[model samples]
Target: MSSPSAAESFPAHTSAASQIFTTVLSQGPLTRSEVARRAGLSAAAVTKAVRPLIEAGYLVEDVDEDARPALGRPANLVRVDGGRALFIGVKVTGDKIIGVLTDLCCRILVARYVPLAARDPKAVLGSAAELVRELLIEADGLGVRVAGLGMAVSGDVDRAEGVVRYSPFLEWRDVPLAELAAMTTGLPVTVDNDVRALTVAEQWFGAGVGLSGFALVTVGAGIGCGLVVHGKVVAGAHGVAGEIGHVAVDPAGPRCHCGNRGCVEAIASDDAIVRQVRAATGVQVADAVEAAGLAHDGVAGAREVYARAGDAIGRGIATVANLLGPERVVISGEGLAAYDLFADHIRDAFATAAFGSAARCDVQTRPLPFDEWARGAAATAIQSFIRSDANQHLRGAALTQPA
Candidate 1:
């Protein structure tokens, strides 16, 4: 497993300090008063916490030229200095690996893609290591050291233990990804479930900002989810808090690779859709794109397949809303490319299945570039660098923020 960089420690002295820094990092360029208000801390506490961060160059302050009053000295705005340190985030998919070089603020500075011809552990790790080295050279050119590497993989991942318990798409099990990556790159590494990594980014800067309870549902190769309850991302007892993809929606539906029938992923995943489309139309479709092509062409069987997938996805989302009562649900991922085909069916199923006020939960669809998931992986690396132990024992603790 990996921890913070060996030679440096975050400037903060306590978890509260880390949280304060996080507040400034996410919603900054504000007066200290605003920082205190959002973080629910006193002004004195905010100042004390921010001092070291500013001194260390992790945070900076500037005159709010427009907000300056004519009668008094201008107030300064506090914000994270993006160039203080560098990080690398990588997202591993079935066919390729997406990597991004990011600054301390989790903003992407450079991105690279590597095709993976093999899914074995050794092959995938080799490709990722090469990509990391390429980004490291980019970091060297910028005169900054990459403090950490974060790998986001789709599967049941135990971040605290830094293990990939199981990844169906990669056909991996019990892979010590963090230790291996750290060895290969000579940098502290953080390995996390892809969707949860994305959630961390969403919670801090994307759609889930300021919401105490929300769910992020991703539709694509797999229908995954990430949940935030009581102001903390839920990893659950088994690092599977939001396995909405595995939730059974139809008792008599198709069998899933996990040996379960009617799981949401079985009916709505890219592979599942292609399989169903081929079966329904009695034609051999090549992939999800080809399957969706039939549907958009007004083929009755193809449209029915998409309708079924949408219904399943909606039911899975409703299960989260009904169970957690989140204030909002954000739908994202690559599958959004075909959202128009099944958008109505998903909403209809959710409306019919939701119980009580859960039906009122606001659901929004946000289209993000494919590289966004890699950026989320970098967010997790930023978290690991700032708070070395925040993810340890996550199954039983509540960490309100990533840092």
Candidate 2:
């Protein structure tokens, strides 16, 4: 078990309370009646849920001066107190570690980045810890306690177990990341899949807000997807839901690090693009950046490689649409930098592959930088802090003695 630096407890313990709080966190300065209407709960229940949170300083209620009537008192508006506490979120990529300090509202206050010299667990952890310490110093200057730390890694992450089951990008397997990070940082740690963490952020404050079903597809070092079904992020029986990158689109295209052939990731991921570019153009490129540069400079083979990758990505996305039919699919990640090279191919292939109304599932692009990914990690920590199931395991809650 890990120990937290500060002992802070969220007062709302029931599902209704969490739902109410989440409503306010995402859509507030809402009035109690508005919260009740949005949350589908009685006004009394909203009041009950808001009281404890307000008393604990997690929420603040203020008079809506602008809404004051000529003959009656103004309605009180309820909102989360973003500065009540702090959290640290770290995103571990193959070559770098990004960390951010965020408040209860998951707003980033400070951000730091460190290059990783190696992908070994120890090396990555060491770099992450240094970046975390820098953020901790920033938090200390703000005089806020960082209640928790969240780490997001690519691949099969078992958030419930706080383990990295398998990360092909990092070449890690069965790593107890939470326990180790907790020991080093002396704060409660939550480990989650990178895309899922980003989805949590999306659900609360980004494109997926108020949407019952949506998908966040990332293209960069890896092709990843996170699904929200029935307003909840889906974690399959083994916490490996929405592995769109592994969707096999071709049998003889290329080999994926996951030991699969012609998967979407094999052709669309950054490394994959670099590999294919080198083969097609017979030019050795140092990284995806150089490969993209070559394509931007009108290199024939390089552009063709990107188009082919786009086709694979489009097919993989169509597979998602055909299977689940989400309301929207938001395409994002570092790869969007090269979107111009393949956007047409992606749209054309998606149009050809999508069936019936599935093609109308609103596809759009958004760019989320590394700092935003770090903020996503913070959002996971915030989700863990407020959700009921997570409350039981929070270090402070675990040590509290019932009155």
Candidate 3:
């Protein structure tokens, strides 16, 4: 991707402006006073921050019909103009790359998927560039410039540096994905950990919205947790936080790919479940879907394997709750396809392991399809665009107004 042009820069600058814009973007169509109140900025500050945004066409103010004044000016509501610009996001999994074209507000306009022929960094980047080219064509049809691109991959990604430090699944290390993708496609790029990127989408528009603290735990090929504390996603000092999957629940448990024994992922990840089920049932359960089916059909040992996986997962969650005290935990992922087989066990284990008020944390499930993950990648791009200080190459271009 090529770099974003000077004219396509995102203009929402300053902490107050970003805060106000985020409040309105996430909970929008609110009056300036409401924006100030919600964002905890003075009304004057809200007005000051909103003017440039409105002038730049990034924000729009509409007169409220319900609360119109007969004599005075109508109450104008400020909101993000979703059609003003466009962004592209890509979520890379071991098997496929899911891409989404989104508006300024992170609403999905078009979604596409392509199978990955290989996991090598070069191959992945080639496929990603191709996918982005396709989305850019879609953006052209809508007559909007693609302002930025976000790529989300699993593992230890340093979003600040736009580097995939190490991805066990992809066997990648120190890949400068952002810079490479920028070269391939002509847009400023933001690369982030897949789960954290997803957490950004959740924080702004999904289950984590309006919550001061919450956790999203994904169960599938891997067990991943995204934590929101005090309304900010905790990236940890090392860019690896809320790694409940690596939390050792049983000292004598199975070995994990991370070189740990009895970690949550060792017992609960898709591969772990498959391995355990095959050993316990003496049946060739080829994959998670088959294992789930076997358990659903009252295969005795197969059900036990799911129960064990659930126990490990619940313990991992309890560890998160004990430490963070989040108000809720949203359980999701492809693994939820077999949720019925292990819901009771997860609940039981969590209840037993949780300490005091931590047990009160609401645990609910929501299935976030791959498209949402792709949308999450878009959200990160939007985030980086708004917070231009982080990416230096994008920063220079971000100073200009969008045309």
Question: What's the TM for model 1?
Answer: 0.93
User: Which 10 successive residues of model 3 have the least lDDT summed?
Assistant: 394-403
CA-only RMSD, every prediction: 4.7, 3.4, 2.7
Compared with the true structure, model 3 gives a TM-score of 0.95
Candidate 1's residue-wise lDDT over 270-356, tens digit each?
999999989889889898888999999987699999999999999999999999999999999889989998999999999999999
- Among all candidates shown, the one with the greatest TM-score: 3
Please give, for residues 1-403, the per-residue lDDT of candidate 2 as tens digits: 2234445767878989999999999888798989999898998999889998999999998976888868766778889999998989999988889999999889999888899999999998889888888887787778777777889999899888788999988999999998788767667788899999999999998999888899999999889999999888998888899999999999997888879899999999999999999998999999999999999998879999999999999999999999999999999999999999999999999999999999999999999999999899999888888883643233322321111
Better of 1 and 2 by lDDT: 2
TM-scores, all candidates, are 0.93, 0.93, 0.95
Q: Candidates sorted by TM-score, descending order?
A: 3, 1, 2
**Where does candidate 1 clash, by residue pair?**
none
Cα error, candidate 3, residue 137 (Å): 0.6
